[model samples]
Target: MDTNIIIVFAIIIVAIFFFIWGKIRSDIVALSVVVMLITTGILTPAEGLSGFSNSVVIMMIALFIVGGGIFQTGLAKMISTRILKLAGNSELRLFILVMLVTGSIGGLISNTGTVAVMLPIVMSMASEAKTSARRYLMPMAFASSLGLLTLISTPPNLIINDALMSGGFESLSFFSFLPIGLITLSLGIMILWPLSKLLVSGKDREKASSSKGKSLNQLVSEYQLADNLYRVSIGENSPFIGKSLQELNITSKYNVSILEIRRVQSRKRFHKPVDMKLAGPASTFQENDLLYVFGNINDIMTFVEDNNLTLVDTQETEMGRNALSVSKAGGMEFSKIGIAEVVLMSSSKLINKRVKESNFRQLYNVNILGLRRKNDYIIQDVKDVKLHSGDLLLVQGKWKDIEKLTEETSDWVVAGQPMENAMKVPRNHKAPVAALIMVLMVVAMVLNIFPTVVCALMAAILMILLGCFRNVEAAYKSINWESTFLFAGMFSLGVAMEKTGASSYMADGIVSGLKEFGPTAVLAGIYIATSILTFFISNTATAVLFAPIAFQAAISIEANPYPFLFSVAIAASMCFASPFSTPPNALVMSSGRYRFIDYIKVGLPLQVIIGIVMIFILPVLFPF
Candidate 1:
């Protein structure tokens, strides 16, 4: 191989390794590849950096900001709530509705954008429906994958469509892949329908619990005991001490339901609620009954004040009332006191540390309410158990406390939302306008009213002018610049491969091996191969790598390249075999609290189903 070819392959090898190993951040890996390509003379400085200016890169960056704006304004949240309410018939029906909504919206917008917009919405609705957020998140992510069946659905499809035209083939039109894509999408959704029930089957009985750090009094309007209702404060020295509600006759005599209660004092010592005797009804009504009664507001107030039974002050409550509904909103609105699920990594300081010995609450103010070890859920007095690697903790605390915990215990990997502040997405009203502009631009481009790249550029410029990006920093930060660099680096690598006959060399080998197996087999091979590549590379890069060869193969067989090319596009875009396959997959990795094995277990089967549908349906629509 020539020096340039050697350099290109070296970059490819490093990129693939980075994707698989993933110890380093992906953007850094991409930038390193760009630097290497430039340093080795494989690409000139301008050529290596040309991806920054690539229309696709610019459009993607702009769309990310627009998507962020949508999230900030809660537009996506509003839409998801409406859709979910409409999906109230059945799980299967709900599954189909969610899939259609996600795929349809994703097709018009970017997949990552679609996911970002819908993530909080999906989690919230899942929580409301009393389902595991993990069960629904993967399906939502898969919907984004399936949306890539259309030319405008995702960046990769648009890039590939343009590349086809540049390569002397007719550009794919709107809904070009609908027949194959919809069938594949429907099959994948159906496969996922049974998954929610399967994974959460055994854990169904444990309802979501309330956190103790905040008070519930702040959540709802309060009323006091009514007039003519007897009122008494049970002091530590009171006669009714250690009496349960049944023993006290609270309901029969006073008609008091004991609506809510909170401990009057807290202990520095780690306390565990054991048997009903230790913490239950026998525990007795403590000082400050904090009783709420169903009666006239005026009457209740008069009775409580008259009897000297004071209402609990906001500061005296365990948790603010506003935070009480975290589970109620289905996971959407919750206390700012952050809650995260962390796993004990092999390197964590928490490994082998007993919860009591660790003093997590005092040190970081983070409460470890529960844990999941293997398949068992531990909600007991967990102070005794030594933490182990891979142990999952249900930690609730302030954002700063969570940050400290993550930093101090490297072995404990925080699953969702970094300790760092959320990125500042532009919140101006113009963002929706910018999004509308982008939609109009895409429509105009598809209609051949203007070049796709040019239309996208104009929309981006208009967005900047409209102050959709607050400043140059906002605009610069909005785009995933690393993706651009990766494209540039890979474009050069692809060029080098073509220049050195590496591409043709590989294509000839594949063709010769599959020729006897027929074009259908050859086509299937290309689809599967590209899909595998996508599990380790950018979808666009995967398309760029295999699209040319697919086109060439179609020519060799004297067939139109549309069906073959469509297969490559859809398959490459559905890189669901690993968490590293796509950004949405990465997002769900932490959000869904999923393990590597979980992705393989769920995604591998779904990918196979989509591949089968594509192979069987593509030829019918486009005709080989």
Candidate 2:
């Protein structure tokens, strides 16, 4: 082996070690590899830095913004809600629907975002069906990976496509991989659906079977505040409309406490309501301000009647309460609201501070409706009580505000059932415009009206200009910079591998070992190798490193390179065997209470089956 090849091999091995060790961020490890390659003269500074300007990198960043717009505008949530409604009570039906919906949506949006959006819905379905969430969660996570069947489904798909294009192959059109993707997705659902029943523990099944499900109101009553918690709105003729909470002193005068205030501005008739702010001393009453108050029922009713405030009934009916509801001004209906249970982390900053002292409402924009410490539920006088680690808080606010709380994972973790109704808030009138932009971007790509990168850039810009995203900062924050840098750095490493002939050398070794076994065996070997690598590394990084080798291997055998390239793309996305393999997998790990062995037991067989199917299918599809 050449000295430069030896050095390149050493760098690659060290980089892989750091990636799996995970003591350092993957992007940082990749950048360090780039620095080493530059210093060793394996790559020029320009070559090392070329990845930053790669069109694929730019496209990935733009796609993140587009996906964020879909999320912020509640389009994804709407789809999830509709799909879940079709699930009914059958566990089998729910599993099939979840896989279909999640896979289809993930094919267009970010898989990570798809999983995040669908997670609460799936959990709620599991609860309604009286089964363990673990049974459905793993399937949902695996299904999300099916998005890779589309050209724009996941980053790895795009990386592989770019690699093929860079090697002078024709770029794949949108939906090119749909046939393979649908086949694998179908096979997965067929295999995993029955396996779930056998995998979930007996204790979980017994709990589901023995227990009669509880309603939202019944669950709230457990906190002992069913009678005290009332949703009342300030009427247009109310006397307290202009007064602040401190000035009105309703807590002392009426023996009722204002926990949260929900306000809707009438300035923009079609705009979604802003987050419900927690009622602090400085919060002033406004017309139609919905107040969640805790107090004596008689006192609250009397106070409402005395002030001409409208009482909004939130009783859980046979149809159950909608997670997101919009009430007009002057109507007795409640606005978009939600109640969530949050458990403070051991290192939470809110620990050791009274609710009032912590400015909990002002800081998090959520009201502390009740607190649970061990077996006791503190509903009355909770504001003065000091919070502690492991304390559970029942908070009430607009669904958007509660959603914001879920983002603060370092301070507290959301516990118990998710407030699904909260996710169904009114879409900004601009939601249609956002959806239209996304469609046009796809149409543009399919028609080749513009380069894929340009089309993505246009869609991202439209998301902001069309009001789907609130501002540029939101669009900016939506980009996962870590993944962006990681892609750029890995691209440089890929360049080094090609420039130093390392990829060709590896390709030769693979072709030599598998030549007697024929091209079918070669394709299977490459697929298996890439699949194993992705089990430990970022799928995008794995695709970047292996794509060139696959292309070179196809060339060595004097066969079409498309099958080899497709194998690389498909293999890189088959990361179901480890939770740490992908973000979607990790996101569901703790929620499902899944162990590493659970993934192996379920994912290993699926991976093997998919590999076997792909080896036979690839040559047929691409004619290698």
Candidate 3:
């Protein structure tokens, strides 16, 4: 073997060791490989940095933002919420719906994002159904990968597509992986049903309560404010139409707190989600506006009569009055509004001030909605009550503003991380726009109107430009920098392996060993090898290393290259055996309270079966 090939191999070994060691982050390990490659003269600096500029890397970053847009706009929540309703409280129905819905969404966006947005919803369902979440979390992680239907679904898919185009082979179409995705999902749902039973030990018979932070609904229920909420609408001829909250002075005059307002935009699209705004001084009341108010029944009734408002007898209103109606997530997933508990300190300057006298709306940009003193709640005249030491005041505001309250913890302390922010979905009024952009991107890719990378970039930019995300900072934050660095850095290692002819060396060894059995056997060998490597290496890194080798193996055997490339993509992504192999797996470990043995018992079997099935199915899907 050449000395340079040996060095390249050495770096890969060290990188893999560090990846499995888990003491350092995988991205840092991959980056160390890049530095070694450049310093050893195996690759030039420009070549090492080339990975950062790769179209594959760029597309992955943009896809993160696009996925964020879908999630932040509650588009993902809407889909999961609607589909999951069919399941109700049936465990079997929940299992099927989780697999199908998560897989479907995961195919378009990254599985990590899909799992994140869906995790709370599934947990809430399990809690509501009076079952354990363990039975569902592991399978949900696997389904996220099984939904690799589109070219952008997983990083491995894009890696294979790029490898094929560079090798002078025809690139895959948008729907090329559709059949594979269907087969994977169908098998996953059926197989995981029985396997997940093992997850429900006696300890797991009941869903574990979240130790993180208080959900909005839980806060509402804790303060006994759910019973105080009322939903009323402005009648068409009401004098309140076209009037601002400041003009109405409802808070002072009526002693009723307008917590939230839901408005239907002008000429609403048939299925478009309604618009919501946190009640504020400048908020204008328009015709047919639904108001969510918190106050005494007499006060709310008098205010409604004075304003000529009609009570909206909705399930939503009954839901709040009944139990602070939770969404599929079992939390109040409000977009424009959120709540937090603020405890006043003994030494605080505002200790003796009345609620309204604190000027919280003007000073802190939050409203004092509920006050808890000792065991009793001051509901009738909240703003009139004088603040005392140890008073727990439940404040409501926009999520971002609520989060800011946590930073200044001097005179008062914000309880449990303001916003439980992850559970709050905001700006869903733009879900229609995000949904349209997603459809447009798919159509553009299918029609070949733009290059695949261009299509992805256009969609990401449009998501930011069209108000799909909260702002540009959010779009940028959506891109997981660690993964981006890891992805871009690993490309350099792939390039080094290819440049040093190390990939050919590896490919030749595989083909030479299996030549007598023909290309079919060689294809199976490559898939198994990639799967094993992915156990200790990230799927993306493994795909980067094996993709070029797969192409070389097929070319040497004079066999069709598509099957070989597709095998690499599937094997790299269908890694279920190791919790550390993928982001979704790691994400659920602590939340699901899964042990390593749990993954080994459930995921290992699924992993082996999937690989065997795909090995046979791929050759038939794409002629070998």
Candidate 4:
């Protein structure tokens, strides 16, 4: 091997060690590799920086925005609701439904987003079924992983596609991996659906059930807020129809505080009717606006009659009853409204201060809906009560504001599941437009009307132009910068490996080791290697590291590289065996009260099954 290749190999070894060590972040480790390659004279500055301008990076950013548009429009949540309706009370039926819906949707949107959207639904379903979330959450996490079978499903797919394109092969089409994806998804559902009962232990179920002992409704009853939450709609002739919250001063006039507003937008084709908006001082009350108000039952009833408003009996409508859940308040528009349980830290500045005196609402734009101190519940007049260390406050506000509150860790420690600000709102009015853009993008790619990168860019821009996303800032925020940087750095590292001949050196060893058993064994070896690497590092990083080696191995054997490349892609996504392997798995770990062994028990078998399926499928499909 050349001196440069030896140096590059040493750098990579150090990088891999750091990745597994979990001290520095993967992105930083990747960036350090790029900087070391540049400093070592292995790659020119232009070559090292080329990844920032790579088409794959641009496609990733565009896809993030497009996925955000789909999420922002509440399309995923709508699908979940419809599927849940069909699932009923059977745990088995619910598990299958969750896997099917989340997997299918994960193909189109970010799998992480799909998991975030489906989590609460699964939790609620598990609760309603009188079962533990553990019975359902592991399957849900695996389904999100299965979603990567689609070409547009996850970042690893894009990375592998870009690798193939860079190697001078025709880029894989959007549906190229459909056959394997479908088979894998079906297999996952089959294994996880029935095995959930055994894989998820009874002890775990008992622990989860005991922890979440009180349902949301039960808590509401405990707080005596059942009658305080009233759903009323503004009548066509109501005087408040054209007025803003500040203008009407409903809090003063009717002695009721407006908590949320659900308004139906003008009817559009293929769009759902209602759009939920958080109520604020500047928000206008329109005709037919559904107001969720908090006040004495008698006062609210008298105000409804006096103001020509219709009181909506929540008991009569499922939507009404759903609105009663504090966690479900921010289901519409991702960040519009959210509820969080925050615990005051021991050294919190607000520990002894009254909520009103601290100007909590003014400072954070969040309402102290309720508070819990030890065994005591303080629901009414929370603003006047003094906060204590270890006091848990149930706060409601814009998700962004709540996020800000949580970040002030010196003052508060957020309890329970970490608030995911990516909740979808009912922006179904924009769904048709968003769907049209995505369809066109897919068509353009499938037919080679444009490069995949260009098609993705056009779709992303259309999402903004069509109002699927509210603004450029929204689009910008939607992009996961960590992922973008990580991929960019990894791309450079891949280039360094190739330029320094490190990839060829590694490929020769892998090819020579398995050549006696022929190409099928070689392919299986590559897949297993990639899968093991993914268990420690990110699937994206694993794909990047292995893609070049796979291509080099095929070159050494004088056979087609497609099968080897496909194996790397498939294997990278088989990161189901570890809780830390994927974001979705980690997200569900605490809520499901799952231990690391739980993932190993469930994911290891699924990983082996997928490997067996891939070994048989790849050679036939790619003709290696």
Across 365-466, the per-residue lDDT of candidate 4 in tens digits comes to 776777899999876666668989999887767767777876788888866543333333334567667668766876675455787678878888998888
What tens digits encode model 2's per-residue C-alpha lDDT throughout 56-126? 66876777787677766655555555655787666688789989888887777667656655665676566
lDDT of 2 at 162: 89
CA deviation > 4 Å runs, candidate 3: 21-23, 36-41, 85-212, 231-265, 270-293, 299-334, 362-365, 398-410, 419-423, 514-624
Model 3 gets an lDDT of 0.78
Top of the candidates by lDDT? 3
Off by over 4 Å in 4: 83-226, 231-265, 269-294, 301-312, 315-433, 469-474, 508-624
Q: Which digits, one per residue and each the tens of the lDDT, describe model 1 over residues 14-132? A: 77677557566555666677678778776678876665665555555555454444433334445556766888846666677778877876776557656655675676566556667
Residue-pair clashes per prediction, in order, are 13, 3, 0, 2
Tell me each candidate's TM-score.
0.53, 0.60, 0.71, 0.59
Q: Which numbered prediction scores highest in TM-score against the true structure?
A: 3
Give the runs in model 2 whose Cα sits over 4 Å from its true position: 18-28, 72-74, 89-95, 101-182, 190-226, 229-269, 273-294, 304-449, 455-486, 512-608, 614-624
**lDDT ranking, best first:** 3, 2, 4, 1
Model 2: ten consecutive residues of lowest lDDT: 326-335
User: After aligning candidate 1 to the native by TM-score, how far in Å is the CA of 182 from where it should be?
Assistant: 1.8
- Model 3 clash tally, residue pairs: 0
The local lDDT score (0 to 100) that residue 354 gets in candidate 1 is: 86
